[model samples]
Target: MTHATELTVIHVPVSDPRVRPLLQELGDEYSRRYGKDAHGEISRYPDEEFTASHGGVLLLLLEHGEPVAGGAFRRYDATTAELKRIWTHSAHRRRGLARRVVTELEREATARGYRRIHLTTGPRQPEARGLYLATGYTPLFDTEADPETIGPLPFEKHLPATATHRATHRGKAAQP
Candidate 1:
């Protein structure tokens, strides 16, 4: 009998080598689904936009030290984080990795004082839509309408203030 390997999350820069496969596959999937090269969309933002120094983050789920899933979030506003590139390796789907990635991104964003998260999944991606809804995101577009007509389907979740944010609000130093 085979045992399941443990999964671990790690923060990394978008330029990290392990991140390449996820990006490539994600671009390929997007292109295939949208019937156009997704290179531009995938590269729309500068890599620095997903780094900690820029008030953003990129993280990956590693299984046996190889990336199996990953996602990123960048500062969207004074109190919101914009989630991007949430992907689970094609072979690793239906195992809840995408949800795990979203949860991790939320935790990180909360730690950084973001009060909410905003994201948009492509219209062609019903799985992503289901994931967001099942995970408590409020759909910004009408659910009964045709998704293709809606273009990118937007969602948002208001995060509860973490202890750090509360401490900041209270004018006290937060414990590390």
Candidate 2:
């Protein structure tokens, strides 16, 4: 196995301006590659939406102080959470940053009492599908009609009960 320096992942508050630019870049790249309108969809959710409701947590991953990935989790119900806005910069692809981001998000979801996590991605995003599958996410029913649906795949992952307690304690210890 190849051993690289351990990457540091930090949570970016929804209020950060860096989030918009990173998200815009992710959308623009997706649209350019897939021949669809993705930037508009990403712009629909603003900082205010995340702050106003206790609906979810948005995080940006920085490598050596440069933002490389972003993802969020929105509560669907008491036991379920939806992973949204998952994206990694083109420059940062194939480095396993996406998988790390998803794992962190899953840990966060568990800490918030979420027992299951779900997400949907367009068929054009093959890399994303692979990451989800590799990370233990299973295919689920697709209920919405997506514009870029090469059959947009829906996935779900169940969280073990101990995941939340462990993450919560770890987070508390990490805090100054």
Candidate 3:
């Protein structure tokens, strides 16, 4: 029999300097793995614009009080949110942390009245692309100008408004 560790999702404010080190680590790893430069360039935007204005939320996946994985979301519009900078430590891969983070972000967005969530993943990152597809995010048509210029494949998931209600109601209906 296998047991899963209890996962806690905490929102880390992006502006918090504590998060800078993690972001730097992730950026370094991402560049090393994909042969792309991301360290000092894209870091400023999230730390400034997205996190500043729209209440960007960074969901950290912690087990036993250690951050093993994390993801961020920024509101794009009333009906849309953008997922960004999702990363799981190499030691924590293949344990479904990425999937859980994405799901948690989607649920959070839905709770905030967003009906759609969007994200972009580079073509070189097959694992990310696979996860997004598996989670029902379809490829988008137009490409937005991003720092990488790596031609990220955009994905969007439109969630039903009633989905949350149904989820909350399942198996706990009034027994009167």
As a whole number from 0 to 100, the lDDT of residue 50 in candidate 3 is 45
For each candidate in turn, the TM-score is: 0.93, 0.77, 0.77
Q: Rank the candidates by TM-score, best first.
A: 1, 2, 3
Residue 54 displacement (Å), model 1: 0.8
Candidate 2, 79-159: lDDT as tens digits: 778888887777777777778789888888776666788888877677877788899998774434442543668899988
Q: What does the lDDT read for residue 18 in candidate 2?
A: 66
**What is candidate 3's TM-score against the reference?**
0.77
State the C-alpha lDDT per candidate. 0.89, 0.72, 0.72
Highest-scoring model, lDDT: 1
List candidate 2 segments past 4 Å from native.
1-6, 46-53, 141-150, 163-176
TM-score for predicted model 1 compared with the true structure: 0.93
Query: Cα deviation in Å at residue 159, candidate 2?
Result: 0.6
- Candidate 3, 35-151: lDDT as tens digits: 888786557464543452464577787778777788888767656788888888777789888888898888777676667888888766778888988999887744344425556
- In candidate 2, which residue pairs clash? none
